[model samples]
Target: MTETSTVLRTGRKFDQVLKGAREVFMADGFEGASVDDIAKAANVSKATLYSYFPDKRLLFREVVQTECGRMSEQILSMVDETQPAREVLTVAAQQLAAFLISRFAQQIFRICVAERDRFPELGRAFYEAGPRNGCKQLMDYLEKAIAKGELQIDDVELAAEQFSELCKAKLWMEVAFGVRTSVEQAEIDVVAHSAVDMFMARYGV
Candidate 1:
């Protein structure tokens, strides 16, 4: 095979393995799932799975991290420097809520909670790599808004974290427990509006 074709095939196999791992982790839980099952689901051998992910823990970590990164990227991409603070916040909140309501969010949260006792490091890694990084990004946006006089905030980091909590509260609980049957656009609008309203009440000049 040509070098480019070989690279593309390898990348496709890696994606297949990752998708398989997510399915196994979601269905069997982190500790209950085995590498062989994942390989079977991915139609790859154990050696191939191991080559792609050194261990199951690492595979699970990558799954969570990939989902979180996608969410963060979506939120970050929506930020417009020239837009009003409230508008930017509304957009960001909507993006965040949408992400928190996804199937991947539900599965990742389940894995984190289930594996906390057996693999505390996995839980910590999830928090640090996902929410913590997201909070930092929010803080950066808040700081810029404050500097621009678009918003007033004494504690940007604290405000950012609070904003996240406000945006995620209901949907997060629903996702974490698999309670919500669906999270509609109406729900997203309601949560985003409420979150933006509260945030503005505190920070608007």
Candidate 2:
């Protein structure tokens, strides 16, 4: 199904159903989550759930899109594009690192990869809402910084993408691979600061 045709309907309880689905999906994954369990968690009936989301895949797609949109909004609100590149990039890195280590990110990524063959739109939704959105935001900041002579970069898009990858340096792989189930604030800070330092080293004017 196409992205626009994914959801069947929306109502007052739409957010309620999504909340319950997100909780269940996070706990049990895509294949493991049950309609009964989701209905129970949402405090709604199966009929009510179906009215909002006719298919389980559609519900999952909605959850991914909603959560990723929320994260993107939060990131945009936290970072000021007018600030010095170091300060702006540090906040951005910290946010990116924290997002990378989140259970939501990990779970959604696994679900998309596992279900890609059957539901390619799921991966597209995740990428457009998550990484692609992030790069676009960062690219705007990089463009301003370049204009101010605070950074030297021929390719703002590449710099933005690199900055995101650099933010993932120490934490992303371990969290993604299940080697670490939890992460500490100190560790996140270390990765964020190191990413900023490295990014500046390569681009600072």
Candidate 3:
């Protein structure tokens, strides 16, 4: 076979493992999930799964990083210099808030916390992979906005963090604990606008 076919075959198997791992992890949570479970779900041999991911924790992290990477792309695409800061941030805030309370995000958070004692680095790695990645994107946008005189900010990092936290507002804690299960778009809009309001009060030009 050609090199291209070999590459495609390898990539296909790699994706199958990830899809299986994600389903198993989401269903069983990290601590309870095993390599055998994932391999069975993926329709691959245990040895094949091991070849792709030697460790379960590494597999879990890869699942999260892959998901977060997709989301980061969507969020970053919203940052348009042609639009005003308020317009751009309002949309970003809504999307960020929605994702924060999403089942996927909540499960990842729960898994990291539940297994933190055994694998403290997993929590930190997840935070860096998802939250820090998003924070950096927001920071980059803020920095560009400041350079263009669209906003005034003394600390871009703090502002980025604050904006995301503000977007979370009342929804994050409630959703994480099962006190709430769903959020309406109207509510998201309200929270996003409020977050933008507070952020602008501090940093708007």
TM-score of model 3 (CA atoms): 0.92
Looking at model 3, report the run of 10 residues with the lowest lDDT sum. Answer: 1-10
lDDT of 3: 0.86
Candidate 3 structure quality by residue, lDDT tens digits, 87-153:
9998899899889988899999998999889888778878998999899988988998899898999
| TM-score winner between candidates 1 and 2 | 2
* TM-score against native, each model: 0.89, 0.92, 0.92
Going through the candidates in the order shown, the clash numbers are 0, 0, 0
lDDT of each: 0.81, 0.87, 0.86
Candidate 2, residues 98-155: lDDT per residue as tens digits? Answer: 9988989988999889888987877887898789988998888888898899999998
lDDT of 1: 0.81
Per TM-score, the best of the predicted structures is 3
The C-alpha stretches of model 3 lying farther than 4 A from their native spots are 1-10
Give the TM-score comparing model 2 with the true structure, all chains together.
0.92
Candidate 1 C-alpha lDDT tens digits along 26-49:
798888889999999889999888
Clashes of 2: 0
Better of 1 and 3 by lDDT: 3
Question: Of models 1 and 3, which has the larger TM-score?
Answer: 3
Find the candidate with the highest lDDT and give its number.
Answer: 2
State the weakest 10-residue window (summed lDDT) of model 1.
Answer: 1-10
